[model samples]
Target: MNRKCDKKCLELSFPAVEAEASKGIATLSARLTQNGLPEHKTDDVKIALAEAINNVVEHAYSGIASANVQVNCRLCKERLEIVISDSGAPLPGLRIPDGKPAQLGSSIQNLPEGGFGWFLIHQLTSEIRYERYDGNNHLCLRFDL
Candidate 1:
């Protein structure tokens, strides 16, 4: 990959609601595809981006209305960096695990309802980071080309 050219970045902001969040992911995926990201890697990027945006819609803006989520995508030589930010409440006791798939039980009854998103995000990206500042939550995900 060529890392020599000037870095390029894109920024998008939308309502911190489920509907708009989906649009945000779509827009990001389209932009990435236009920038020469491979189809398989673009699929991974879309999944990770959706997971991150959904987290904000589901967790951050619980009971709140009219809030917004901000997303910034930076294209570097070796990887693409995405930063998702929301003005809602921060998650308590948040942790970014090693990029490993969650162990699942054999039966469907043993499945969990809410823990898969983080695992999927970690698995799809090479790096993950989360922080809370000024009453906002910021999640960063990096995908290697």
Candidate 2:
């Protein structure tokens, strides 16, 4: 069960690129850890946030040289909510997979080459939501703390 208390929110804006994404994840992970979040839970948040930011950098702003990605994190006593937004091309028809873990095959040859990011995001987070508003793509992820 989750309960909400007074919220402490942090907002970060950075370049929508692979390097910035890594830095954002590191900053977020550190903040969460400093606030007394468990190590495993913090790691889960970091991984999910990395995937979200990377999706924006790779797919949303592929041709663009530079753009901005905004991350807003709201922390409460029992839950943490993160919203990542970017002013890039919105997904035509973004369809997240059903919340199921990706199946691993028996051999290395059967390994997936790509398309595992969303699966991991969904698996790690308690809730995942996406929207496009006012020319910006917003992806929201929630975790029960």
Task: Identify the leading candidate in terms of lDDT.
Answer: 2
TM-score of model number 1:
0.84
Off by over 4 Å in 1: 1-5, 97-106
For every candidate in turn, the CA RMSD to the true structure comes to 3.1, 2.9
Pick by TM-score: which candidate is best?
2
Each model's TM-score, in the order given? 0.84, 0.85
- Model 2, C-alpha of 116: deviation from truth (Å): 1.2
| lDDT of candidate model 1 versus the reference | 0.80
lDDT for residue 63 in candidate 2, whole number 0-100: 83
Judge candidate 1 at residue 12 and give its lDDT: 95
Residue ranges of candidate 2 with Cα displaced over 4 Å: 1-5, 94-106
